[model samples]
Target: MFESFWRANGEEATIVIPGWQTMSYFSDVSNLCWFLEPEFAKQIRRLHGLVGNAVVEDRHIVVGTGSTQLFQAALYALSPSDALQPIPVISAVPYYSSYPAVTDFLHSGLFRWAGDANAFQGENYIELVCSPNNPDGFMKQAVLKSDTGKTIHDLAYYWPQYTAISSPANHDIMLFTASKSTGHAGTRVGWALVKDQEIAKRMTKYIELNSLGVSKDSQLRAAKILKVISDGYEFPNSIDAKFFDFGRNHMRNRWERLREVVRETGIFSLPEFPSEDCSFTGDRTSSFPAFAWVKCEWENAQDCAAFLKSYNILTRSGKHFGAGLNYARVSMLDRDETFDVFIQRLYSIK
Candidate 1:
């Protein structure tokens, strides 16, 4: 019984090579609310300028320490005004832990942790949905009970590497950050797609309150990276091949390695990953980059996470994602040599 619920077999996995750039870029931010330097502000504007007709008066852009900050701001904007009748914040379990925590910090005292949107009453919440969801990598369809019920889609990993879809404005209050795709976590820049003018203003207010204003320097750096992305220049590795190609190949190889690791051992299992063929007509089924979420047969994800950590392999357990306790999240950024060693270590276990 414990075998299914036991800790991961790859705990404390040595980090001989670093993971995503975001993991290491943000250790120095002592504070996040200060105004950015002038050039930095210009740079941020430049980056947003690359969006190319994507931004409109209806759309409000704000920089955050990361999408995490934006998420908080969006929640605050949606907070109920009347303390006596607070709007409920509902989310799936196994969700990004921040959702509930942010709900608490807003002190709305109205969040109801329902297992899924179906359980959430429309009148209760301005829903927060994470598509291409954190641990599972599954994208929730644009859903609405009626024309007016609110839903904020978190598309933090929706770049071409992860999904073929490029236009990110389809969802309401879309949340994104460079930390996931561009490796610029240090900039702490993020944005939200707010269809409501009032909510947009409130979000800006929250941003101002949270950090006075996001640093202009960080915003500038992010803007530079955005310009390069628009110009087809790679940030971490300025290779001739498209950055999306690099990311796709990199993640694809890692996922293959993961498959190899799991297949080599007779004791593991995986859910059938939805294929690109399953994508909508315009959706590209070509890639699922950014992460490798695997559902292990383990009964409890926390035990699986503990096991991985014991091996010095820092992994976020599935329970953290709000479902499938047997699963764990793994970064797909790995060199072949590191991946080989990781596989060897994984196979060497039991």
Candidate 2:
């Protein structure tokens, strides 16, 4: 049977992620302020430990509207003066779209997005690296070893899907959130692992001024749920037994189905999944949890996105993600039936 990159194989099904339990009460009634328990705080610290560097200290957990808020704060903290000589934000091509957005929002006059690192002239800039990156699931090897520099690794998808239990720390300020890992996007809980004291202090100050020190209640809830997921062990239970395995199988199957759809249809293209090195060993085709990036040469990325929307299928076009406007991103997290539907629609592209 022929396959395309946009479809899911196997059983037809409908699926929604059953991960976060924190948002249940909000449906019934909403309250202005929430309360927190002490134990919950302790557990959050433990969850922080799971993804944190053992040697790194002075870590503080602050609940954000989302990690996006922290990203803005980081930009402001590292912002420069003068519009012409703005602090250049260096990021890999095809990065998280918001890297430039948050930078522009917070300090538009003082900062600008610098796409390539090689073209950079000097050492006075901030590099935002997203490991297990958004558009493509590629993680960087390590940050450039420099004392005057600060690197923030957005490990938003750093859970069992892409990383090992003992993956070494990649950068000074490693960002992690409960959204992608535990499927708790509603909690708006995220933490930054900062190795620099002054930068860490600045982040704390920004949080204090930004949202009044993040809700202790939300932090506690996020921590409590994290402890339950963490169980008595270091890794989350999601990976211990067969949860991670099932996810991997499901994702790989989805990717294969999608690949077949693309190969057979021949309307679009894709990045050949790279071979696994010791640092990253997983199914290359479907290793990513939520989405896969597609290389579409014939259509503008925005036009492609609009075309998919006509079929009632949503996709993230790459125009906003970076310089490339010829690629699109589609999620593999949908149900089998939805994937099949997507594939069927994809076949109609040509």
Candidate 3:
């Protein structure tokens, strides 16, 4: 869908990298901190300022291959290096599916994957709070209230297009991705905004040891894309339409059409989101989530994923997200043709 939009609206957002451009692995004066590209860092701040979705002031930026890397980096940074026992890392039910894999794959002594935040009874822990959560698209908060517990706010879907940007998010550790915000998943670029300098250094160190540093080419491209987005907000008609406006309109329409189809089937149910005033847009708007959390309402269809899979409609089972088998997740960010086919298949199902 976004590719079609880019094709129609002019390709001014496109970036052409020269052969010699960003040849060096180093992005700044210090070779130690190669994870961050100076231009990309500046552009990120500018973009966040224009959108008002995140607070950039007084925060240290740490660039990663993507938010996935930053998630692990945050885990590494927060875990105690000298502790005898491993720190528990957790999120609420229906959380991001990859959290467990990412936390436990290394089998590091610093941290270990703990099931759910509500069930966890620990003093020192790392809680991941994904506002505008992945599967269900609900706003979330940290359930663990211990002072020793650290919280990492995953704000990947907290953009104005996905959800209302009521105010600037000022969390100690926040993660944002270019894939969800700019539809640049191929670029493999994401960033973390850290309030604490020590934590920021540790996260940057994690990136340094993990992959040496992020790709310079990807960083340059991300900078260009972010610059385009920021510039579009300032000069709305420069590219005939702004990126957020286009995305928000497209997502809202898709959600409406999907809801209509599901309602007609009467076998599936979707979560309802309330309308709220978006400070950036200056209007009340409902959420246009990136994924559709569909629940099987029919008594016969206990496993929603299996039911969808029978029709060749692939979906992420809710069991992976710690939910019942009746729930499943479908992407709303697929291409226009794929989305149309999905709607057709969904409507045809009795």
Q: What TM-score, computed on C-alpha atoms, does each candidate reach?
A: 0.74, 0.73, 0.97
Give the runs in model 3 whose Cα sits over 4 Å from its true position. 30-32
RMSD of each: 9.7, 8.1, 1.3
Write candidate 3's Cα lDDT for 18-135 as tens digits. 8888777678866235557888999999989988989999898999999999999999999889999899999999888889998999799999999889888979999999999988
Local distance difference test, candidate 2: 0.59
Alpha-carbon error at 2 in model 1, in Å?
38
Per-candidate local distance difference test: 0.57, 0.59, 0.90
Q: Residue by residue across 188-215, what tens digits does model 1's lDDT show? A: 7776656676777677678777776565
What TM-score quantifies how close candidate 3 is to the native fold?
A: 0.97
Q: How well does candidate 1 score on lDDT at residue 7? A: 25
Total clashes in model 3, counting residue pairs 3 or more apart in sequence or in different chains: 0
Model 1 Cα shift for residue 115 (angstroms): 5.4
Sorted on TM-score, best first, the list reads 3, 1, 2
